[model samples]
Target chain A: MNERQKSKLVVETCLLAGKIMIENGSEMVRVTDTIDRISHNAGATEARAYVTLTGIIMSATPDMGSQVTAIDKRTFDLEKVSTVNDYSRQFAAKKISLGEFYRCLKRMDKDVKPFPFWLQMIGAFMVSATLEIVFRSNYTDFWAAGFVGMIGWCIYCLTDHYTDIRFLNEFIAAICIGFMSILLIRAGIAKSADDLIIGGLMPLVPGVPITNAVRDTLSGNLVSGPSRGIEAIMSACALGFGVAMAIKILG
Target chain B: MVNVIIFSVCVYFATIGFGLLINLPRKALNMAGIVSLIGWLVFHTVNVHMGGYLSADILGTFTVGILSIFASRYKKMPVIIFNIPALVPLVPGGQAYQVMKCLAIGNYALAKSNLIQVIFIAGGIASGFLFAEFLNQLYLRFKTYIITKKATR
Candidate 1:
């Protein structure tokens, strides 16, 4: 490719890298770092990336126009983040040519595969049951929490698949967890409704976002920090509201 | 004690479960679980002996943060992959749930206290992670300085 075309390709590659990292729930600082590293490794004289929770704006050299990519959806996929890190490290070390690196990134992005549904359900079950014992120090509600948590996570995934509304899936999942926990208590299968509900809600809480918000803020990304913090708070509020609604309606 | 062992086992498995939920790479899952187990053990011991949740949380997350940093370096992965999963057990999900329950029952007083507690715990976790990062940065700088000094000699 010509020099101009090469610069443009570099910008596009950086933008694609940033988009994947941000969309896969990488911290804002790491996103910018990865973008800058990719552009720099591609021989850009002056490359800069400004990343926030919602978008990424990157420019490489004055001749090549800057590129902007908006990030609309985010989900936890640390595996993708690690893969991008590995690819960038390889590119920086000259182990992979820029063309090959770009091609690998494109293929990886297109062929994203998360854990299967059944395995994820089992994870949810184990998280709820084991956390119940850890927090409440009781095994009476172990199976109850597991079943409720599995069903709640199932509802969450289903709602996410069917609905496009933000935070609605978490709300619906929390409501299901509440109702299930209460039902189990009524059926004399669970000893404590509080323990069961808390355990089941473990899978739904916004732990990653909250931690990322703190880490971003601490690392001096003022823009993305509070934005991610607000996202965490809003989801927490959605969960709390759903649980409250369930209790008000049934209790 | 038997209780400590049980809690430790639960935390290890629970951390792995959370790791799977977030799609952590398979090779790092066991290490993340061990990090979480150590952190929770520290938190449990501190809380039981001292009767302070905030301090226990701060110390627990500090240990988790430091260990995850090392684990990431050893595994050649991003620190976040290990940090997020290991931090799950220390997150105050139960207290947050109780805060909502209090509000639902019209118990404003209890809700207010629980809200403050949640904020404090969140802050503690944040500071703990920050301190760990700070120390890591310090260590890196020190290592670089020693290398340069050796070169000059």
Candidate 2:
């Protein structure tokens, strides 16, 4: 390829790497740092990257000219993020060529696998059951939490597939969890639904987002910080509202 | 005590399952579990001594932050993989639930207190991480400065 073409390729590749990282839930500062590093090592004299929870914008000024690329796809997959980090570090160390790096990134994008549905359901049950133990609940609560939590997760998976609206999906998941908790209680499966419902909702809570929001604020990314903070609160509220709806309607 | 150990063990396994649900790598799942177990242990231990929820939250997260940095370096992986899942156990899940439960029941007073408590806990955890990161940055700068000074001499 010609020098100009290669520079353009580098910009595109860096943008792709940044996209993968951001979509896979990397921190905002880390996203910018990785993008700049990749572009700089790929022969860009000047590189700038701006990332938020929703999307990423990057520009690279190589000797040929300047190029900008933006992508708006966000998901949470840490395996992909880790792979991108490794690839960037290797590329910066001159251990990998641009073409090789590009190929690696494409493979990383496609290669990361989520746990199977059954496994995730089991995991959901385990999470809630153990949370009951931590909450000092009785054995009956533990069993009921497990059963209800798995049902809640099944509901979550179903809704998550049917809709791309995250808040709505979470709201529905909480409602399902609350409904199951109440059923368990009525069936004499458990004494109270409070701990069971809380435990069941544990998996859906936005723990990582809130933690990242605080970290972002402390690191001075004002826009991303408050935006993520609001996102966390909204998700929490959605889950709460769903549970409340279930209680109000069922009782 | 046995109670603390039991709580930590429960947290450890729960975190492992959480790691699985989040699709963390196998090695990372193990490390995240350990990191969270340690965080829970620290929180309980420090709470026993200090008798305050906020201080325990801070100390617990502070320990997790340091361990995550070390784990990231050792495992040749990003710190986020370890930190996020590990922070799960300590993430004020209980308080958040209480806020929602109270709000659902129309107990605005109880909901307000729960919301404030969640804010404080989240703040404490964040500050702990920030402090650890600050210290880590300082160490890196000091090491580089020493090396450069020696070279100049």
Candidate 3:
């Protein structure tokens, strides 16, 4: 393919990949790679496919995440561009993958100081701790912990959307979970307080992420998988320290 | 005073479990407080009317777990979310608070006792949870194996 054709393919692929990400909660890289593979399957050369993929990624732009869920389905299905490409364009316009968009965010890095992960952790902790405080019963502490967990998850989701890096978000989540557990223990800490503390930390547990990241890396996804594993490990360490400190200092 | 505290605490935890199970909104989740008291009443009646030192807690905790699991399934929510809610009533936070308070006041003996109690409680919670989860996994695996074997035969 010539330069012009390669550029067109890239733009088309990026838009299409973005659409798929929104509908399927898929990784942007994997989605794009699949499209690149398909193009190759369709007889495109490797070098041209690479350029096309790069172009598609560049064209995805910022603001795709917040916009993805907002656009109606009809806008994506134009008959002239073929249904798939039309849908892809719609995804591009709607901003399907926030994280991927942020991958391109450094191009215009000024004026966007994403909310610090620590503050979000504190806020999530507050919501969770309060619930445990009010409900001195069996379910009270657990509910509070879950609430806190969700808060951390939400913050991470937003951060992951913007930066495409999971490290800070996971750390923040771990801290929140740790704080929630300590709060639960300090508040009603009777014979069964373990249930509360342990339960509260469930959401922020790094087990799954750590396991998956390692598994992926071992299976040959160094770029994507190991990054996730490292993030999980960091988060787990943060959580352990946070709990120890809270218990020691507050006591 | 302890009775009042018990009633209120039970209600709150129950509310958390019920709200989670039902997939209610944020505002509705708080209602776990109001309804769980009724559950507490069941325990209270069994102990108070019957004059038993039954601790009502064991049954109550188990009830929360069973109900919370059911609630999550019904609500179409993740079990992880509901797991915390079910554990709300069993946190032993009060004991922990008392232990810390004793230590703060330099009552070392009482603090020591409370600390041991805290360990016991946490340990009990973990053991019970492990038992339940293990049993469930075993049962599921056995059932699946039986079904598969029968199908092959």
- Pick by DockQ: which candidate is best? 1
lDDT string for model 1 (B1-153, tens) is 988888889899888888878889888999999999999999999989988999999999999999999999999998898889888899888888889999998999999999999999999999899899999999999999999999999
> With candidate 1 superimposed using the best TM-score fit, by how many Å does residue A14's alpha carbon deviate from the native?
0.8
lDDT of 3 by residue, A133-245 (tens): 44344543545565555565565556656764435555555455456555655576433443444444433444334323433443455664665556555765564454444
Candidate 2, residues A41-84: lDDT per residue as tens digits? 88776766666666665556523444444545455678888888
The DockQ-based order of candidates, best leading, equals 1, 2, 3
> What does candidate 3 score in Cα RMSD to the true structure?
13.9
For model 3, how big is the iRMS in angstroms? Answer: 12.7
Better of 1 and 3 by TM-score: 1
Per-residue lDDT over B1-153 for candidate 2, one digit per residue giving the tens place of the 0 to 100 score: 777777777898899878777788777888888988898889878878879889999999999999999999999998878888888778787787788777777899999999999889988998899988998899899999999999999
Query: Highest lDDT: which candidate?
Result: 1
State the lDDT at A153 in candidate 3: 57
Among all windows of 10 consecutive residues in model 3 chain A, the one with the lowest summed lDDT is A71-80
Per-residue error at A26 for model 1, in Å?
A: 0.6
Candidate 1 lDDT tens digits, A114-168? 8888999999998999998999988778898988988999999999999999999
TM-score per candidate, chains pooled: 0.98, 0.95, 0.36
Clashing pairs in 1: none
